[model samples]
Target: MNKTICALAAATLATGAAASEPIAVTAPGPQGDLAGTLIEPAEGKPVVLIVPGSGPTDRDGNNPMGVNASSYRLLAEALSQRGIGSLRIDKRGMFESRAAIPDPNDVTISAYAEDVSAWISVVRARTEVDCVFVLGHSEGGLVALEAGQKSDDLCGILLVASVGRPLGDTLREQLQSNPANAVVLDEAFAAIAKLEAGEGVDTQDMHRGLMPLFNPAVQGFLIDMFARIPAELAAGVEVPMLIVAGGKDIQTPVTDAEALAEGQPAAKLIVIDDMNHVLKPVEGDSRLANIATYSDASLPVHPELVDAIASFLEDSKS
Candidate 1:
């Protein structure tokens, strides 16, 4: 990987302990600048790179579309309190890196997988950890898997709310499950058809055959990536692995996590009770109420979720 020539969006500071303030750093990306938080470890501890799920989400896990849950930041703090450090990054040309691009939607998993390796090089230089752990949430789990495929800098991989099977299959299932989107179900089916054909769905004007959830650029990436499953990638990695899922997770369900462990002999799977897709507890069956928790920073992620990951990382070190 070529060394990135960068101008600091946030300056790198003296490293010793994990500071309360997350240092801003720019790493190499597919299009424009990619921003990240180089979360230093307290006492120069090992750092984990918390990869955000697929979206236009920033390093802190918040998106402009109204997802304000500081998932990444909170996770970093929880890990830091456990003496585990991490780096959280915005996807290429998103948020702070938005100025780094002309078109933001033209990105693929391969590009993101490359960026992960590049960030590891930049992050490891500033950390005291012998290796960094990758904590991938939702689609970011795919990025973590691909990154481990390329480099050995990872200490271990903790797949949080990741997909177990082919993503194409999962999306098709979700299209059928979401009632609000029932009318557009045919569009979902047609979109999948185009993707399966390895052809791009023409999105000149958002047609009835297109879902806003799948942009042309992102759809291209997903089609290529869905062909690559977490288990298929995990099949080659020998590092310590932890596959976590919330019992009620609507996105990447626990079955997916189970499928991942089935692919890797060494993986340990944990299904947390009362936890939903975002790692929050929800009452009753209202999917809307369940999704509402994604915005509540006041609520702690199921303590079990953090505990499971921390225990794995700590045990790996020992």
Candidate 2:
């Protein structure tokens, strides 16, 4: 794993009669060092690795690109409150993990899967647990599936608002679903096509508003990601699996979770009502409200989402 323990301890959080320390943790990455937070209830207790989604999302599940919802952070807190341990990590080259790599855009899905494996080993070593559960949200679920193929130590996998089909298909659906993206729909689809075909899309003519998403720097990585099918990976998983989707999620719909469960018929699927992509509760069927939750960091994630994850982890351990 090449993990170096420079652990800094923090006060323990009460979770029922038990409590766990929130410790700063790190592991070696291909380019540098990966950083994360580890909350351990006790040695040998089942732990979860909270893998963040796409873009510049950090270990806390908040990104500067208008996504400040602390999805991962809240999930970790909720799990800890139930006496479950968890590790939420920053991808190499972002936020506290910025120094882990020279450039984030130079990475691929396989690299991320490898990082997951490293994290699994590091977490097990540090917590003295035999295995760890992986809870991957959105794009991170794909990484979890790939990492599962590489390691037998994983206790199970939880896919939250993750895709079951190829990324190109989901990208198209998401772009077309939003009227505000209508102006850039054609350009976005064209770029996605090029990336899916393993080619680079020139961004010189791309709309300035879409540059952050389709910039040349990230094209190579996007091309690699677009090639991996999450369903195919899920189908090959031999470990316990759970797929959670939000009924009101605008980004990745409940159907995606259905497809994942279909791919792996043994997997348990749970669809939470009013839960959005950011894990926050959204009212009615308002897309505006759903999207607004992305920026509201203070909003608590749907309680059902946490309950589902904690229950799944407990069952996995048994």
Candidate 3:
């Protein structure tokens, strides 16, 4: 946690474009249908697909886990200002995407990749751009990487806070580093190991003592979750990429972004000095309030965060 990174994420926010008229669209999803808004540049410009992160997260980069800054919305607005079009959407069975699936947790990275394709189809039909770039945060970054591998129409990939190392490895490191609970540390490790092996540990079983680690829904994702590193996946991609990490991001450290960038032949890396996971500027190494700002809509995300992505996107076009 970088004490000086109080403005890391705040630098990436777009404060002006939220009031603009954003184009809205709803596309068919695996479980049901997803609702989305496409914010295009007034002058007509290339578009980006705003991929949502994990666990009931909305198109706005918000989640039921407490993030509500509408980070993705701010990002889209910022991109619009840069003359780049963007499409943000609700995940399957959440908010407007509620109809996309029968059960929200029944989704995995592959499903998300499918959703990206669906959104791309919609973007192509309406916009003149030949392909849309993918901007994925955290878990969403993995989805974007997967999609980029297959989507020939993909313009490029922009990964923010994406898991560069295998998720299982990151989980182990987090557990070892966190001072929270010593009791569940080994249990959590065992469960993660099982999930990594593509085995299911009953979240209900006590002797196994790995419930939260192996929830039925998330387990399926974990089967493939910790399997690949985002950098390795993006390494083979021909699309241009920009990888940004915050100096103080406790969830996914700046090193994670560096590792991903390393795997690629020519990807740019911009490490903000003091940005947190939520793009907020933190005053100290204490991550105590990091989760708190996720709900702070009035707070401005770090400008550098947005600049890094926008700069990379613009540079790629050049």
lDDT for each residue of candidate 3 in 172-208, tens digit (9 for 90 to 100)? 9987886765777877887888878878876664444
How many collisions per candidate? 4, 0, 26
Give per-residue lDDT, candidate 3, residue 269. Answer: 80
Ten residues in sequence with the least summed lDDT for candidate 1: 1-10
Ranking by TM-score, best first? 2, 3, 1
Instruction: For residues 73-183, write the lDDT of model 2, one tens digit per residue.
Output: 888877776667899999988887778788877888888888888888898787777769898899999988988785577889989999888899998997888789999
Clash pairs, model 1 backbone: 17-41, 17-42, 18-41, 18-42
Which tens-of-lDDT digit does each residue in 124-223 have in candidate 1?
7766458788888898998888877865677788899898888778888987886777777777777777786677776666554454766765776767
Better model by TM-score: candidate 2 vs candidate 3: 2
Whole-structure CA lDDT of model 3 = 0.76
Q: Estimate each model's TM-score.
A: 0.87, 0.91, 0.88
Considering every candidate listed, which one attains the maximal lDDT? 2
Show model 3 residue runs off by greater than 4 Å: 1-19, 207-210
Residue pairs clashing, model 2: none
